[model samples]
Each structure stands twice: as C-alpha cells, then as structure tokens.
Target: MPWLISCSAGYQKATNTSLATTFSNAVERFQRSYAFPGITASYVLPDGTSHSAAAGWADVENGQPMTSESRMLAASIGKTFVAATMVSLAQERAIDLDAPLSTWLGQNNWFQRLPNHRSLTIRQLLSHTSGLPNHVYLPAFVETVSERWPEPGNPFTPETLVRFVLDAEALFPPGEQWAYTDTGYILIGLVIEAITGRTYYEEVNDRFLEPLGLNATSASNKRRLSGLAAGYAAADNPFDFPVKTTDENGVMFWNPALEWTGGGLISTSRDLAKWGAAIFGGQGVSEEILNTMLQSVPIGDDMPGTYYGLGISIFRSGPLSPVFGHGGWIPGYSSSLRHYAESGITIAFQVNSDRISHQSLSEIELCLARVVISSGEKTDCVP
Candidate 1:
C-alpha cells in the first residue's frame, strides 16, 4: 500500500494572504447570521489554491476560539475519501468495478442468509443503489452498543459493523431505485480492509490524506481529537446538550465505528479544501478515476437531477451551474462542499451545531455562487 506521508509541521503552515479577505468576510457574516458556537469556511479556486477562516469557539466551555487549524468531523464528507480509495484500488486491478463483490469478499453464510445478496456489485455499493437498508436508523444497534460501551473509549471494528448489518434486508434489487444507506459504505469499507489487508484508516492515510499534505486531518477512532471541535446540539453557546465524556450526548454520540467510511473522518476546513484541490487538480488518482467519481447516477424521480456518483451528490438545475460534492449532517455538525466545475470554484463550510438545516447550506451555496458569477473572476470564492 502506498501511504501518503504527512507534511512536516513547517510545510503544513499555509500562507494566509491569498484567502484572508474573502475568508474574513464569510466568517463575519456567518457569525452574525447564525448562533453557531464554532464554524469554519474554506474555499479552493480553480488554480488549486485554498483559503480558510474559523469563527466562534471549538469548546464553548473552555472559551476556546475556533482556529483554522481545528479539526472537526467531516461527517458523510468521508464518503468522498472512501470512493476515491475504491476507485484507486479498482484502477490498480485490486478491486473490480463491475464484478460482483462476492469475487472479493467470499460468499459468507451471511450472504446466503440475506435476500439478493449475491446481486450486490461494487458500483451499486459506491453509488448507493444496492438497495441496502439504512443502518443508521437501527435504533437497537446504537442504543444496545452504547449501553455496552457508554463512553467514547471504544471504536467499532469493520467486522463488527458488518456483522451488525448482516441481518439487514435489501430495500430493492441492485441498481434499482436509490436509497441512502450507511450500510452500503460500511460494506465498501469492509471490502477495502479485506482486499488491502490494511485497516480503512491505514489505507486512507496512505492513499489519500498523506498525498494531499493533509497533515492535521485524519480518520480518528477516538471520541475527541487534539485541536478538534466537539459537536453540540447548538453550534453557539448555551449548548442544550454538550458532549460529555461520561455519557452519550443526546444526538452528539461520537462513534467512529458507526461512521466508518460512511461518515467517520476528522478534518479542518483548510485541509478539506486542500483535499479538493489535490483530487481535482489530478494529483493522486488518474483522470479516468476522477471522471468516474464525478459521473452522476439518477437516484429517483422525487429529487430532480439528484444523482449519486462514487461518493458525492450531483445537483444540476441549468447549464449556468452544476454542483458536485456531498452535504453531511451528523448530530451537531452540518457541512456542505460545493464544487462548480465550469467555474473552477469550490466552497466548503462547516458548522458546529446540529439544528442547522440543509436549506441553510443551500442558501450559503447560493450566496457564494452569486458572488462568483457576478464578479466573473477566477480569483476568489466569496461566501
């Protein structure tokens, strides 16, 4: 496995001049508009350059200010990393994109136990058309597991998480209707582990993170990371439910095992934008892999132009702008990454509160798009 080496501390220091003005403006607006405790916004322009800003607090209890360096959970944004890993491996011929998963993961009795298990393919898993039930909705699993391990001391092994979903039945035939399911990504993560003979963390670290020089970000197993933001029900002060080390913090449970490839990684806005620049700038993966990752597959009619490609979502309304990337909500954290290929603009925002709506993310995106389109410049992504 080719691992990406973390950047040296000196190299990790980013020059602030390029993005200082736009980032500062975004932060000021975000602070005024929302009561979020902490928020981070980052932008990557077409030239593969990035700028970022951090506002509010990472830990309101300690009065700690949010820094551009503070790492927060990427939530479902980790899906892009998982998709990249799979595509890279597929390109290497280690995993087949079209072959049945059984070719890689032998037909365990568990497959015989589930309906239409043999029909599952690698593409279906990546695009989320595998018809697998959403594992995150399994009330018993989280409650049962938390009761056993209340504190954030433990992590879920890939095998353990797969076993938990073995009993889950498919929602439809493979490549049929679209359904959002964490179970699909969980299986993908397991496949990565089995094929590489390395843990998901190790594979991602080696294959993705290191190459991008995302030294400060990582796929964390621990509940709270150093220089990391703690999730809260409210993004700002007076957090109705703050995550305590002792118990499951209402909706803010920190389960790296549960998120896995679906939503586990920890990163800062700055590193996240760097990741966009790395992948889109054709650094590690081939052009074919990048194209494959961007091709959007129809989900269902209910959501117009809403397609799942590799790890991200594609939302297209008109020729003016077609956005690519995913939006994530894990308890107190809500994040969205929108990349406009035609404009060569990427906007990434992270909020440290749970109640922040997807509509808010969409609005933020619209605001940024207007600024970019009006200025008609490849210079800055103002949000």
Candidate 2:
C-alpha cells in the first residue's frame, strides 16, 4: 500500500473554496477506495477558519448523508482526553503522576492478585510503561465478550477487566520498556475514580468537555446523544476489501462499560477539532505539565520515529511533519485526530467503518496535509 507522501515545507493559507474542494475530493476517493459507509472530516486553522467535508452515507439503510455534526466513536483518541485530564489533576495536586497506583486505588483483591502492583506509577500507566497485560489481547477475554454480545448484563466492569488480566504475566517491569496497553488506561481511570470520588466519565466531563464547551464529545456507552452517525464494518476484512451496509457491526452492541477510558469516546470531527486546539494549544494544562505529557519513549524497532507519550502517540516518520494526536478503533468506527504544530492546523476525521487500516487513515491525514501545503504562501494561521 503506497501512501501519499507529504512535503515538509511550511504551509500557506488557501481559500476555503479550494481547500474544501481538495479535501472533499480526497475524502471521496478514500471512501470509494475503502468502501467506507461514511466519512466526516473537519479542519481548524490557527486564524479560526474551519472547513468541513463529508462523503457517503451516515445511515446506508435509510439513505442518510454524513454531515459535519455526525458523531462517530473516537476509539483510542479518548486516551488523549484521559491524558489531558490527568495533567490537569496533577496541576491541581489532586493526584500525583509519580505516585504508585497502589497509593490511591488501594490494595483490593485485584491489586493483591497482580504482582508488582505497588511498583506501577500513574506516569507509567499514562505512558503505557506499566507492563500491564492488555485485556483486549487476551483470547479468553475476547471469546467471553463475543459470546455475550448483545445480551443483557453482558457488559464487563472496569474491575472485572482488571481481574481478567490479573493472572496474566507482565510484559515488562514497570517503567522499563514501552508497550501499548488498554489495561494501563483502565487502571488510570480507576485511579481517577479513587482520587476524585467520582466516576472517570464525570471527571472528564467536568474537566474537559465542560470547560472546552465540546458538547459533541462524550463517552460512547453513556447517554444516547442525537446526530450520531451509524457505524458499519467491511463485509470481509478492512484491508483491500469492499464495505457493505448490511455488514454493519455498530459499537452500539458493544459493552460501553468495558471500553471506559481506553477507547469509548463518541464525538464529531468539529468537536474533536475544537478539543485538539484546546488541549494541545495549552488551554487546560500548564506549559511545564504539557511538556511533560508530550515527552515520549520509543516503542522499539518495529515503529521508527514513532513514540508513545502519556496517552498520545508522536509520529515523526517520513517527510511529513510531526503531529500530536491519536487514532481510535472500535467495533464499527475508526477516527484520527491530528495537530500539525508547524502549520497550526488541526484535522480530525471519523468513518463508520473500523475495517480501514491505520496506514489508510494515515494517508487520509497526509492528503489533508498535502492540500494545506499546496495552497500557497504562509499565512498567520496559528491555533
């Protein structure tokens, strides 16, 4: 799969007409190529100009069109929200990042069951260095969930998820080698609940959504908000496969209680663009704390120029500029949120299909970057 390469040169502001046309065409190509049920994308320039484009069907069965306001599950992009919230909590002295998980969560049955429970720090959990076994990767866990799908009382609690991985061995010693684990963020959510005496969702709402006024973003499994785009999956696999509307496998069937802080966010590209500007542009955390959160560790040779920070991934590979954001994958949705620091531009896109490969998503982002760059000379666009 060849990716559309991006030029490293500085970007100039292009007319909204031209940018929107380019973006819309690119999105149409992406949709047709991957047979995505629908795709919604929005970009915010530093000067506050916003451009949005949507292609395909939000509800294929009903012939609904994808719109800028259509919401899609934001998968792991929720981790970036978790990371920002943690930074805010640390600043308020509500929780210490370096503190061991045992300090706040307490030594319950789950803690006692897992060795080295006391050695894992909040920082490690945020950075995926806690060596915790990812519950999603466990075959038994996946099978159990699949067996219970769409059934009453099938949702797994955060504690239950921790218990499922308690017997599994650690991937590495805490704070040693970097490894991405949804279990780490699950623990982080639990820690937040412990320290604040409120559910993780509540804290996120108060700290992030409320302050930023991002009304479109919320936990997927929680309340049913309006304008949510229906989710779908490819008929076969996502790679080099065709998508079918009847092949729908929406996240509505998944247990929201299980995904929690790991990847349960549902949001629109417009709201996510606002979130990217607020969180990455230093609206929530102080400069020092934000810098700390952005500091990343390499994940080894498999992913060159790719590093994992607290709840975020930093990509510096190829001629494309470095971006600070995260991608998300749930049952019936895929999302990508990116902030190009040099251009002061933030782009976010969400599709109803989860079958799209990460590489394909990256290319979508690259296409957006290419459009922004090819527009003309530099402007005062700073987010």
Candidate 3:
C-alpha cells in the first residue's frame, strides 16, 4: 500500500494527477482495445517507488480476475537472464565470450554439421550476429509444429530444436551481418551447459533468481508452479491456424522445453520489474558486463535508430531518449521489459494474448512512458 501511495504522490507532485488512477485507466483502455484475456504491468520510478496494475481475467474461462501479481510466460525476456548469466561466467573465466562455441559444444553432432559452427563465438550468438537460422521462423519447422501442436507431454530437446535449422543456409557469414535468431540462443544455452556441466536452469537459478530473491521466476518447463496465468491466442487469425481454441494450457499446447534459453521463462510483472532495475541498474552484474550487454550492433535502415544488444533491443530515435529492453511472444503470451536510462524508470508488462503485435506493444510502451515522464520531476524527464 505504501508503494502505491508513493507512486500516487510522485505523480501528483509532477503531473497533478493520481498515478494509480491513471494507470488503471490506461490498463482498461488497452484491455478494451486489444481484447486481451488479461494485461499486467509493474514499474519502478526514478525515486525507487514501485507500482503495479492489472485488468481483465487471468483465466477467462475460469473467471479468475487478473491481479498485478499474476505470473505469465515472459518469452524472450528470459534471454536477458541468459545473457547476464553468461556474462557473469565470462567474468569468472568459466567461458570466453569471443571463444568459438565449438570449443564448448563441438562434440554435439548438430554442431559438427552446421556451416561455420566452429567459428561462431559466444558474443556473436548473444548479439544475433552468428548468422544462425531462427528455427521457429523456418517454414519446415512451422509446418512440423503445426502438425504436432497441442500434444500433451510432447517436448523437444535443445538438440532437436537446433536440427530444424541445421541444414538451412546461414543468414550471412558470422559477425558480418546482424539477424535475430532463437537458434543462436539455443546454442548459447548449450554452451552454458557445456561449460558449467550443469543445466542452464540451474545456473540461472543460482546466478540470478536466488541472489535477486526472484522466487516467482523459473527457467524450466517442467515445474508446474501454481497461479500461472492462462495463455490465449487469436482464434480468428489464420496465422494462429489449427489452434481451434484460445485456451493455451501447458499440457495442451505448449512445450516450454522447445523455447529453452531463447524464450522460455515464467515470471510475474513485479519480478520482471525487479530484474530490470537490478540488471540495468548495475546490481545484477559487473558494470563492465552490463556495458557489454548494452553495446549495440547497427541493424540497418529497416529498423532505423534501433539496435540489438546482447539480449535486449535498443531504441534511440524516438521522441523519447534511449531505451533498452526486449519483447517476446510465445503462442499465447506476449511480454516486454524496458529500462529508460535517462529517467531511471523500468516498465515490465505482459498480456495473455500473442495476438497483440509489436507495433501495438510499442504504442503501449509509449503511452506508459509518457505517463512516467509526465509524472516524474522535470530533471528526470530531461534527455
């Protein structure tokens, strides 16, 4: 309650309005516009005050009302955790970021078969400069998943997922061009596992979740933690074909193992906001490593002023100042985690509908940013 009160006070002092009231109104507007089953958002202001808001039903069929604490799949936001863990390991000399991944995971048959696999480095994989094909986007992989989806208990291993892109041509020579590929992260996970001789889940749990006390976050697909929000997709969209119902029960349609390191973690908005504050605020890792993670690669004109960093996206061209974070989509969930460096604010939100597009998500972020900027001290809003 104090947190909420502080947020309201902060907003009133800056904008002469109540933050909770305006935030709740914004959530309602987004819910009505997107028709999402639920939407949850949390934030940490420049002054370290925390606030959260939720709207709609976490489980539409069950009529469970959504709360700000609802846990949901965070998709590629999990990649930030992976990047942090790897960077920490690099600091420990457990692995080298620029070392060829083949040094660690070369024994695997899949690695031996992929072109330039021996030359791909950890840095390249993290930044999506490895020219690896994104298995989830490949037509054959899509067809296969479409045919086999919603099958209960059907899971895929990292090796199995990597095989989907094994024979496909590279996007470009390694480090010569930038592309986004989940397969690269899959390899990164394997390398992490190989170096530590422990499952990637274990490393992340110890390196991040435990130290940060992020009890609600999990890296595995097998743990059936309670209170997880139901996932939903568009029933009317052809792209969401063969998924007859919006229901996205894990046993029915999702195999968290398939997403693995690329897009497979579950967390609440509160936990994600905490993570954004810690990781981007330099509490989660060394300042040097955080800087490395923030370093950007030119993504070209298709995405002007946008760049992809270690595990997050950077945007510097908008009306707002430079902001960095990642967005993610699984079948029934979409999530975003962002940090406004100039304002020292972090916003983490998730909707239970993958039907929402990136552009829509950006609009939502912009809306929230405007409120935060308006609600903060004038100096905090200065670019």
- In candidate 3, residue 303 scores what lDDT? 82
lDDT, residue 332, candidate 3: 71
Error of 1 at 77 (Å): 0.6
Q: Residue-wise lDDT of candidate 3 within 321-377, one digit each (tens)?
A: 699889888777889888988878898889988877666787778677666655633
Could you estimate the TM-score for every candidate? 0.85, 0.89, 0.89
Candidate lDDT (C-alpha), each: 0.69, 0.76, 0.78
Q: Show the colliding residue pairs in model 3.
A: none
Query: What does candidate 2 score in Cα RMSD to the true structure?
Result: 4.3
Candidate 1's residue-wise lDDT over 155-185, tens digit each? Answer: 4565555666676666888887788887788
| Candidate 2 displacement at residue 244 in angstroms | 8.9
Tens digits of per-residue lDDT for model 2, 156-220 = 77887787788678888888888788988888888777778898889999888988888988876
Clash total of candidate 1:
9
lDDT value, candidate 2, whole model: 0.76
Name the regions of candidate 1 deviating beyond 4 angstroms. 1-19, 149-152, 234-254, 318-320, 372-383
Question: Model 1 TM-score?
Answer: 0.85
